[model samples]
Target: MTKLTLSLAIGDYDRARPLIDGRVQVDGVDLVPSVLSPEETFFRAFRHAEFDICELSFSSYTVKTSRDDCPYIAIPAYPSRAFRHTSLYVRKDRIKRPEDLKGKRIGLPEYQLTANVWGRAILADFGVMPSDVTWVRGGLEQPGRPEKIALNLPPEIKIEQAPADKSISQLLSEGDIDGILTPRMPSCNLTDPNVGWLFEDPTAAATEYYKRTGIFPIMHVVGVRKSLADAHPWLPGALFKGFQQAKALALDLLADTSATKVTLPFVEEQLVRAKELMGDDYWSYGIEPARPTLDAFLKHHHAQGLSSRLMAPEELFHPATHEAFSV
Candidate 1:
């Protein structure tokens, strides 16, 4: 067989390091992987279609997919996932609870960011809809950042671009915005006394939310170029199997007790607690395993005016990735 050669751009995550280092290889394919930061990878991929396969923001992916002009088709291999409770930063004196956000100004890097969508969904659960808050969109640390993809938001949803000279984090620090939905913690929260998390204990709040909702929000998915997938129908499944094997190896390394594979202490304890809370395959990657999270995100994406319509969870993934042969 003539192995297909392709370029892949994804975050330098432990779960994907095996593929990057060639410990795991996609069957019938030769990968030239670039381990880039998620922000750059998403921007280049969505804007220019620079790579044969890449990591994509789920929100932006859905927006393009719903428009029926997306350049790539995703597999169920989620490269990034997190609970979004920790993604929200607020003024301690102003936004004490989720409801406090109603009618307030909120700053975010982009209206179509996956983390912000999940963060807004958290507010919606508290009876605050997207329309209830005014959103200021801009870069988080630097000025002039734009949405990776265009969004056709509903008229009722309000989003304004921040001043060309300032970033969203600057707006939060200056008290121009009541709160912020961010993929990363803002430097203002570290230096400013008034900036804090709405959830006093984000970990506890996220755990409680998970217990109630069974959702581990997915941030990024792996996408193969549509032209490539169409030319080689087997590509999606090959990449899927490669990622699963890589993840299993990463988990095994984490479970090893002799020396912690990660820099964090109490790796074993955290691993044990995670399995207790979410089961053995907590960070599972597949349509069936991730349906609840996917469904919730799709609903929120549409409600927040990112998706053209409410998309089925399965629609985001390639058909070859929907199921695998069991022997």
Candidate 2:
């Protein structure tokens, strides 16, 4: 009956809840779940080690800021029924093709974000060089904040301060920005009546690239401090079971219209988005990063110079747990 603290990002809780809700059992251990957003939860976890487990992005995992001793647990990849592809949105009347983006100013919420990273990679695939366009960095608070710059951006790219009063969407609507790189969600509709989608499937090219190069980018992952894992060896197993249970519950709910209707609005929206981006076959099972997937991610991480050395997927994750839950 050992109590294990499990932290999940707020944005991802809907999918993770069932695992820690006590329905899933692992070696007779029970998992207790707590949820928070990535920044708030991880920042606190790093300071106090308050939670035994947490969910984090692959980029965040590679960052120098993260604790070195944390061990990642691979979660099953559930086809994001609500997943949407990121798109390069431009003022419809202004730019009609990908080539038209040359010399155009593009607005980004932050450079360090996965959307930006993948967006840049996608642009490269389309024959756009880093120097061919102007990049604008947004969401700054004071005169200088190092977090303001996304990361590892080349010198040719210029960083402009976004307005303090308006949201990026608002700015795009005002025609202050020629284009933006964002997910294909309704909320990111560029606010401009003139704004239209330039690239329909930004990740498609990347996905193909990954399949070809065996270098897929990792988005989000569940992490546990190595100290906590050592203190409680059974904890990792318990968590894996909990996640399996959650995935089962999610699948069951998705199959039931009555249950789906009662779920959170965001969950419903995600389902729609996933279908649009990944198509109908996406929801057959959860999406878990397997060995090949992790290997692909590691290769890309190294190529991007995001990590100093390539950390083997086995080193970053719990070996036994991953094998037991191989998806």
Candidate 3:
């Protein structure tokens, strides 16, 4: 088999380190992975088709898939997954509860971001529909943030652009926006006492959410260029196996408490608790195992008008990556 060398833009996650470092191989493919932040990777990948493979936003991918003009075909390898309970930032005075966000001016980096999709889904569970809040879109810490892909939001969902001179951080601090649904805190949040997270203890909220709905929000998935996948059909499955193996290696390293692989204390305790709540494959990569989460995301994606049509879990990835044959 001739090995194809391709550029892959991905995050510098511990689970994906093995693949980038050459410790793991993707069948016959030779990967040249450039680890980058989600913002840069997803933006370039969608905007310019910059890399052959990269981590793409699930919401954006669903949106592209619906249009049937997607340049990339997704794989089952989800490199990033979080509960998203900590994603919201609200003024302590105006927004005390989730329902209080109704009719408020809510700011976000982008409406179609994976984190925003999950955040809206959770908020809707509390009876706050996407149309309920007036959406203010802009950068979180800086200026000139735009949606990764085009969106045709429904008539009821009202969205406005933030002034080019200001960012969401400034908007929140000045009380121009009542709250923000974002993946991270505003820039002034650390220095200013006026801005704070909507959920004080997001971990507790995430745990309770998991307990209630059994949903672990997925953020990003591996995407391969559709043309490349079409030319080399084996590539998708190979990529899946490589990522799966890389994650397996990381998990094994996590269990090795002898040297304390990470700087964080209570590694063993947190691992035990996480496993108890989400099971061993909490950071899972597959169709069947993640069916519920995928289905939930697709439902919210369509309900929120991120997708023109309701996409299925199976439609997100290449058909070959769905199942494997074992000896």
Candidate 1 lDDT at 174 equals 91
User: Sort by lDDT, best first: what order?
Assistant: 1, 3, 2
Overall lDDT per candidate, in order of appearance: 0.91, 0.55, 0.90
**TM-score for candidate 2:** 0.69
TM-score of each: 0.98, 0.69, 0.98
Quantify how close model 1 is to the true structure by its C-alpha RMSD in Å: 0.9
- Kindly report which residue pairs in candidate 3 clash with one another: none
Write candidate 1's Cα lDDT for 1-327 as tens digits.
999889999898999999999999999999999999998999899889999999998888889999999999999998899998888999997888889889999999888889999999999999999999999988889987777777778899998889999988888989999998998999899989999998999899999989998999999999999999999998999999999999999998888989988888888899999999999999999999888898899988888888888899888899999998899
- For model 2, the stretches where C-alpha displacement exceeds 4 angstroms are 1-14, 25-32, 42-50, 65-84, 129-132, 140-160, 163-166, 183-190, 200-218, 257-296, 303-305, 310-312, 325-327
What does each candidate score in C-alpha RMSD? 0.9, 5.5, 1.0
> Which candidate wins on lDDT?
1
Assess the local accuracy of residue 38 in candidate 2 as a C-alpha lDDT between 0 and 100. Answer: 59
Location of the lowest summed lDDT over 10 successive residues in candidate 2: 140-149
Model 3 agreement with the true structure over 1-327: per-residue lDDT tens digits: 679999989898889999999999988888988989998998898889999989998888889999998899999889999988888888887788898899999999999989999999989989999999999999998887878888898999999999999998899989899888888867777876877888889899999998988788889999999999999999999999999999999999998999889999999999999999999988888988888899999999999988999888888899989997799
